[model samples]
Target chain A: MAARILIAEDEPYIVESLRFLLGREGHSVESVNDGAAVQARLETYKPDLLILDIMLPEMTGFEVLRRVRESEITKALPVLVLSAKGQESDQQRMADLAANDFVMKPFSNRDLINRVTALLPAKTLAGSGQAPAAVEAPMSSDRE
Target chain B: MAEISTGQRIRELRQHRGIAQSLLAEQVDISPSYLNLIEKDKRKIGGALLHRLAQRLEVSPAQLSGVEDASLVRDLVDIARVLSFDGLDEAIAGRLVAQAPDWGQAMVTLFQRYKDASETATALSDRLSQDPQLRELSHAVLTQISSIRSFAEILKDVPDLPQDERAHFSGIIASQADRLGLSAREMIALLEGNPGDEIERSQAASAVHEVEDLVNAQRNHLPHFETAADDLRRRILAAHGEGSITAAMLAHLETKHDVEVRQVEGDAFEGLVEEGVHLVDLAAPRTATRFDIARRLMAMELREEIEELARNDRLSGEDARQVARRAFANYAAGALLFPYVPFLEAAEHYRYDMDRLAQRFDGSFEQIAHRLTTLRRPGAEGIPFAYLRSDPAGNISKPYSLPGLRMPRLGGACPLWAVYAAFAEPHKTVAQFAAMPTGERFLFVARRVAKGAQAAGAAPAAYSIMLACEASYANRLVYGDPFTGGREATVTPVGFTCRTCSRQNCGQRAQAGILQRA
Candidate 1:
C-alpha cells in the first residue's frame, strides 16, 4: 500500500526533490510552503505521514506539531520533522511533541527515501529490507 | 511502586556483577567507606569515580551517572532513526558525548519518557473507555511518575527533599500534563481496578517495547540525520534566490552545525592617538569604520617591517613613525582584498579553514582574521575575531582587533590560550578552551610563525609571531583539530580586559575595569 505523505517545507528545491524521491518510491506526496496550511491540508488531503521543517513563515513547525497533537482528529498522525537547526535541544523538543521521525537538512536522497519508507505504515514499508541505501553525490555550490 | 535510588542501583549493580565493596574500592583506589557513601547516595560521584565505575560496569560513564536508563536508550534510538539520513557514525556520537555529557543524557531521557508515556496513555485510554475519568487519571499518574523519577534523580544530592520542593515538582508535572490535556485522576483509577485490566497492561507493555524500538532507531539514526539535514540546509542556502543570506540565515546554519562564531571589536588606544604621530587622524579620513582604521594601522606596522628589511639599518624614532604610516597602507590593501561582510560569509561556508579562505580571496591567514575583525561595518558586521600578536616572552606587541578585550597595554597575556603554547608546537596547531579570571570562557586556536625578521644585528634580534582568535570564531580556521577530547586540559584561565578582569593576584595591574566583561 502506498503511504500518503505530506511535506511542510518553505524551500522549493527541497520540497521538489523530496516530492520526486517519494513519488519514485510509489508514495503519494503533498506539500505546503508554510505551517499555516498544515491543518487545512490535513482536513482534506489526510496524509498518513507528514515531513515538516522548523523555520516556516507564519507558525513554526513546532507550533504546527503542537496543534496536530492537540486536535483529536489528527492526534495519532505520524509526523517526520525536518530542520536546519540541528541543536540537541531542537531534536529533544521534536521528540517531546511526538514526531515519528526527524531528518536533518543536506540529506542524501536515498537515505531520505529510506527513512521515509521505514517510518511509513508497516504495510507500506514491507519490501524495504535494512540494507544500506545508495549514496548520491552532493550538488556543488559557489557559497562554500 | 517504589523507585530505586542511585545508591540502590549502585549496590544492585555491584551485587549482580558479583563484586564486593572493598574490591571495587580497591579497583577505583578509593577508601571502602567513600565507595559505600556513593552507593548509599550519601555522596555524589565525581567525574573520576564515575569513570572508574563505568570501566568496572562495562558501561559508558553516562550510564553510570544514573540520570538516564532504559527509556533513555529508546529515545536515543528514535532520534537516530530520524537523523539516519545524514550518514552520521558512532565516532561523531562519541565526540558529542565527550564534549557535552550532561546535555546528551538529558536529551536521551526526555525523549524516551515522552514516547513511553504517550504510548501507555493511548492504550490505557482505549481499555478504560467505560471509565473515562480513570483513563484520564492513569495517563496523568504515569506522566507524573516519570517526572518525579527524573526530578528525584537530578536532585538526589539535596539530601532532604522538603514538602514544598516536592509540591513544586508535582505542580510543574501537573502543569505539563494540563498543557498536554492529560488528566491525572483518570489515569490512577485505571491502574487501581481489577486484574483483567492486564490486557490493557499488555498493551502498555507493547507501548514500552515500541518506545524501545524507536529509541534504538534514534541512537542508530541521529548522526546521519543531522549530517543530511546540515547538507540540505547548505544546499538550500546555496540555491537561495534573489537576496544574499542574512544574519538570521547564518545563525540558522551555525545552530545546525553545532558551532559558534565569536566577534572581537578593536580597543580604544589612548596614548598612541595623542602622541602626535597622527596615524589615527591620517587613516580616519580614508576609512568609514573603526576596523578599517585598525587594519590600516596594522598594515602600516608590517610595511615598516618591509622597509627595515630593505634599508638594512635601524629606523630612527621619526623614521619608525613614518614606517607605521606605510604599514597602515598595507593594512588598507589587505582589507580591500577581504572586506568584512562577504569574507565572513565565505569563512562560515568554508568552516573557517584559513588556507581554504586564503585561496578563495588570495589573502593570508593573518589577513583573514584581520579582515574578519573589520567586518564590524555597523549594520552588516561579521563575528568578532579578536586578533592578538605576542612575542616569545608574552609581551603584547599588536592588539589590532577587539580592543575591548584590552589585550595588555604592556605585559598581560594568559598562558592557557595556546598563544604561548604555539611556540612549543611551532607550525602545529594548538586549540584550547580558556576561562578568564572573571569566568568568561573562550575557545582559542593558535600557531607560531615568524613574520619578516629583523637583520642579523638589529636592536630586536629575534621576533616570532603568535596568532590567536576566540574559539567561537575558530570554526573558520584550519589550525586545530577541534573534535578531539582533552578540552579540560586545554582550558587556560586568562584575563586581559582591564575594566572587567578580576585577577587580584596579578602584579601587572594597570587598573581595575568592569564587571561581567566579555
Candidate 2:
C-alpha cells in the first residue's frame, strides 16, 4: 500500500533508514526532526499516518499526542508511538492517549512494516485485516 | 494503659517528697531491699503495694502508674548501651531516669542530636557527590545507547545500503560508543568520592523524621487514638443528635466545651485558637473547616491520651513531641470522622475506592488517603498499603511504608513512579503496576490533591498523594480492577532510589546503581 506517512523523530540516521525503507516499500514519507515541528508539518503534509518518537527534542511525543488529539483536523489520524523506554507502563500510556499502536525501539523491521500497513486507511491498502473500526473499514477481510 | 513503670514513678515521687527509702518501705510495709529492687526495675510492684506506696508518697495511685517515665528509662538504657561505663547497666539507667530525669533527658537528647547530625552529614555528602553528576552522566550514557542500538541494528539489517551511508552509520556508532565509554569513566569517578563536593551540614534536626519514626514503629496504627476518637464520636452523636459529624462537633464544642466558633475573613492563619475563641478562615474549603474543627475537638477532648501516646522513646525531644502532638490530634480527628469499623466496612463494600469513601464519609481525598494508612486493626485490617505524598519538586513530605515497600528516606524517589505523573494532571487518578528491582510488585494509585484553602492570588498549594500495596492485593481495590487483581498487569520497572537500585538498564535511572558501581 502506498500512503502519505510523516515521521517525527530526533535521530538523523534512524530517520534516514525509515525514509529509505518506507520509500522503497512504495509509501511517500516526509520527516520532522523534533516534536515542535510535528504539528506544523502535520498541517502542511496532511499525512495518512504519523510515526512518533517519544523522546523528540523541543517538545515530547506525549505533548504532541495531546495536542494532536485535541486538534479537530488531526484527531482521527492513526499514530504509531515509538519509544526506547521498553516499559509496559509506556505502552499503556500510549494506548490511553489513543495511539493506534506502540512499538518499542529496536523493533523488528518486518513487524513495523506490518503494523504500519495495518494502521493505514483501508481504502489505501487492500487485503489488510487489522484496520481499526475508528479508521476506515477493511476493504477485504484477508487475515494474515 | 500503664504508660509508665509503676516502680519508676514510685521512686521518683518518693525522692521528690524527700522520704528516705527505709522510711517509705516501712510505711508501705515492704522490705527496704524489696523496695530498692522494685525501684531499680528488678521486680514488678502493683496492686495493693502500689497503692500503699502512692499513699505514703502523698500522690494518687494513677499518678504513680501514669508518668510514662518508662520511655525515659528506655532512652537512658539506650544511652548506656552506646556509652557503657564501669558500673552502668539497665538497672542503673532505670534508677537514673527515675531519680534524676532532667540529667537523663539531657543526655539522651544530646546523644540523639549527635547521631542525627552525623547521619545528616553523611546523607548530604552522598547527595553532593552522586546526585546531579550521576544524573547527567546516566542521561548521556542512555542517550548514547539509544543511538548506538538504532544505528547498529540499521547497519546489520541494511547490507545492500550505499557505501557512504554505511560508513556514516559506522562512524556514528563509534562516536556514540566513545561517549558511552566516557560516561562510564565519569560514573566511576562519581562513585569513588571525587573531592570538592562538600555540602553544608548545618541543618541537622528534623522533628518530622522523629514523628515519622514513631509512627512507623507503631505501623501507623494507634489503638488508643482510635478508642479516644470513637468515644468522642459517640458522645457527640449522643448529645447533638445524628445529622453531620461536623455539625455534631460544632454543637458539642459550643455546648459542652464552651468554645466560641467564629468565621473570620482575611486571617493569615487558617485556624487559630485564642481566649477560647476558635477562629476559622471563612475562605477555607468546607473540608478544611470541618478538619480544623475536628482537630480542635480532638485536641481538647483527648489531650491526655494523645500526650501519653506522644511520650514515646522514638521522639528525641520537646520539638518532636510537639510535632507528634499535632499529628496525633489530626490522626484522632480522622478516626473520629471515619469511625474505623464503619469506614472499613464502607471501604470493603466500595472496593477501596477513594472517591467513594470520600463521598460517603464527607472527607477530602487526602483525608481518605490518610485514613487508609490507619486501617491496620489486626484481623479485620484493610490491605497493608504504603502512603506517600510529594510536591511538584519531588520533595516527599509524608511517607509511610509497608513491610515490603520501602519509601526512600534521604533522597528523591524514582522519577518513573506514577506519583510523579499525577502532578501533570491535577485531580486525575493514575493507576499503575510497578515492580521494584527486588522483584517485588506493587499496584499504585496516585492523584494530585489541593493542599489547603487557596487565597485569591496565591500560587495554589497542591501535592500528590499515593496509595500503594503489593500487586497480589490489587484485586481488592477499585483502581486496580483494570489490571484484574494485578495478575495480568503490565509492570513498569521502578526503584526506591537510583543510587541504591540494582537495575542497570533503566533508561530513567539518575545514578549508577550500587551493584553497578561495584
Candidate 3:
C-alpha cells in the first residue's frame, strides 16, 4: 500500500537527504533535479504525491503547479509544495492553488516525515508501518 | 457603558478637589469648550491635557483618566442608583454642588439601586467593576470608537450638493472608508449631507472616477524587464547559494564580460552632462549618492556596536569598520559594475541573453542579473524592475526596486517567480511566466551562481538570484521563445504592486492586496 512519491528538487544535498528520510519511511521515491522532466515523469510514473521545490530549473514550481492544475489527468493529484522561499505571500499563493501542504526547506526531519506521512493514503500508511517499525527497532536496539 | 468620559472624570475630580472650572481650565491650559466637549464625550482628552489634569487634581494621570482604576465606573453607577432613591436629583436641581461626596445625596440613590439588585447582582457588578483587564479592554474599545466617530465628523465638512452628486461623492468616500474598514452608511452619516442636482452628481461621479483611475494607473505602472534577466539571476544563485557577494565574483564577471566598471569616491557633485544621458548615465549619479549615504549610515550605526564587541577583545573598532566598509564597498562596487544604462541597452540589443550579456559586461551572471533592476531612472529610464537575491536556503540577502514596485517586506520572494527554479540548474537559464497576486503577468529569467568567500582560502557560497521584468517588454527578449513552443508565447502575468496584485491563485502570496480580491 506504500504509495509512490516523486520529489522534484534541484539541490543535491536536499534531494539526497529527503530520499534518505522518505526511503526510511518506506515509500517508493523518485527524485528529479529540474522542472523540465516533471511533466514527462508525471505522465509515466504518476506519483500519488508530488514533493515539489518552488525553485527549479527550466520551469518553476509555480508553473508546474499551474500545469498540473490545468491538466485533466493529474489535476486532482495532491501536491505538497516544498520551498526555500519562506514568505507569507508565497505560502498564501501555494494555499490558494489547492496544494495539499507546504514545507519550507532547511526543514526539520521530523516535520518532513510528519507532512509526508499525513499526505499518504491509509493503505500506504499501513504498508509503510511495518518498515518504520523495523527501522525504529534497530535504532532502539543500538541504544540498548 | 455609561461611565464618566475622561472629560467628565476631569470635571468630577476637579469638583472633588474643590477646584473651580476656570482654575482647572487654567491649570490644564485648554479652552473651556474643549474641556466641556471632552466631558461630554464629544472630544477625547489629549495626552497633554491628561497630564495637566492629573497635576491639578492631585492624582496620577492614569487614575484621573481611569486607565488605572477598575471600579470607578461601578462606584459612580452605585452612587447614581443610591442618589436616585434619596431624591438627590432634586437636591442637585436646588443647589449647585461644588465638591465630591458633598453630593452624598446622589450616592444615596446609587446605593439603593445596588441594594435592590440583591447580592447576586452585586457580585456580577463587582466582577465587571473589579476586573482590571476588562476595564482596560473597555477603555481601549471606547477610545477606538471615539476615533472612528471623529473621522466621521471630519467627513461631514465636505460640501453639500445635489442628490445624485451626493451619492457619487458618497461612493468615493465609501471606497476610502472601505479601505479603512468603515461602512457606506457610516461614511454617509459622517458626511451629513445629500447630493441634490444632476450636474453636481455628474461632477462628483467624475471626481470619484478620476481618483479611482489615478489609483489604478499607479497600480498598473509597475516596471518589468524581459525574461533574460530572471534567467541570469537563477543561474548565478544556483551556482552560489546563500553566500555573500564577493570581490572575486565581481572580478570573474568583469573578466568574462567586456563591460567596463570604474569605482569613484567622494561627495562632490558635478554639473549634468550637456548631451542627453542614457538610462545608465541617469542612474549613475544617484546610485553613487545612495551608496555613499547607505555606507556612511551603516558605519555610524554599527560603529558603537562593533566597538562594544571589540571591548570584549573580539575585534577592534578599526577591524569592525573595516569589515563594514568592505561590505559597503562591495555593494557600491556591484552597483557600479552593473551601471544601469549600458546594461539596459545591451539587454535590449542582445534580447536579454544572460550569457551573452555577461560576456558583454565582463560580469558574473549574478552581477548582471542584479543590475538589471536598477535601470529605473525616472525620465531616461530602463525597464523599471524589482530585483531579489536569495541564498540557497531562501534567505533574501538583497531586495530593491524602482518607486512603483512593492517587494515583500519580509520573508521571501514570490515562489511563483522563476528565480527559485534557477537554483536547480546552475548554468542553464530558466524561464517562467509568473503572475503577481493581482494577476499581472511577467516573464522572468532565473539562474544559480557562486560567489567567493571573504578569505582567499574559504569555500565560495552558492546562492540564487532572480531578475524580473514586466511582460510588456517580453517581446524584446529571446528567452520567451522556449515557452512559446512554435506559437507566440503567451504573456505571463506578474505585478510589483503587492497590495493590488490580483493573482489570487498564487500559493506564494502571503497576503492578497486590495486588488487581488474577487
Question: By DockQ, who's the top model here?
Answer: 2
**What digit string (tens of lDDT, one per residue) describes model 2 on residues B1-518?**
22346677777778888989999888878899999999888998666686677667866454576433454555454444333222345576666566666666555554444444333323434343346555444434444555555554565466597999888876876666556555544544565454223211221245676787677656688777888789878877887877778889999898878997888884644555577788887888888889999999999998898898789776756767888999999998999999999999999999999999999888999999899989987567888889999888987877887655766544578899999999998858999998888888899999998765577775668789999999988888888777773454377888877755788778887776554544
What are the candidates' interface root-mean-square deviations?
17.2, 8.0, 24.0
lDDT for A105 in candidate 2 is 52
How well is each residue in B366-465 modelled by candidate 3, as lDDT tens digits?
6666556545433445565666677877666555432334343234555555667788788787877665544555667778877542334555677777
**Model 2 CAPRI rating:** incorrect
TM-score winner between candidates 1 and 3: 3
- The most accurate candidate by lDDT is 2
Over the stretch B82-118, how does candidate 1's per-residue lDDT look in tens digits? 3231223334444445455454555454444444455
Every model's TM-score: 0.27, 0.50, 0.29
The RMSD of every model to the true structure, in order and in angstroms, is: 29.3, 23.1, 30.3
Ranking by TM-score: 2, 3, 1
| Candidate whose TM-score is highest | 2
Q: Each prediction's DockQ?
A: 0.01, 0.03, 0.01
TM-score of chain B of 2: 0.62
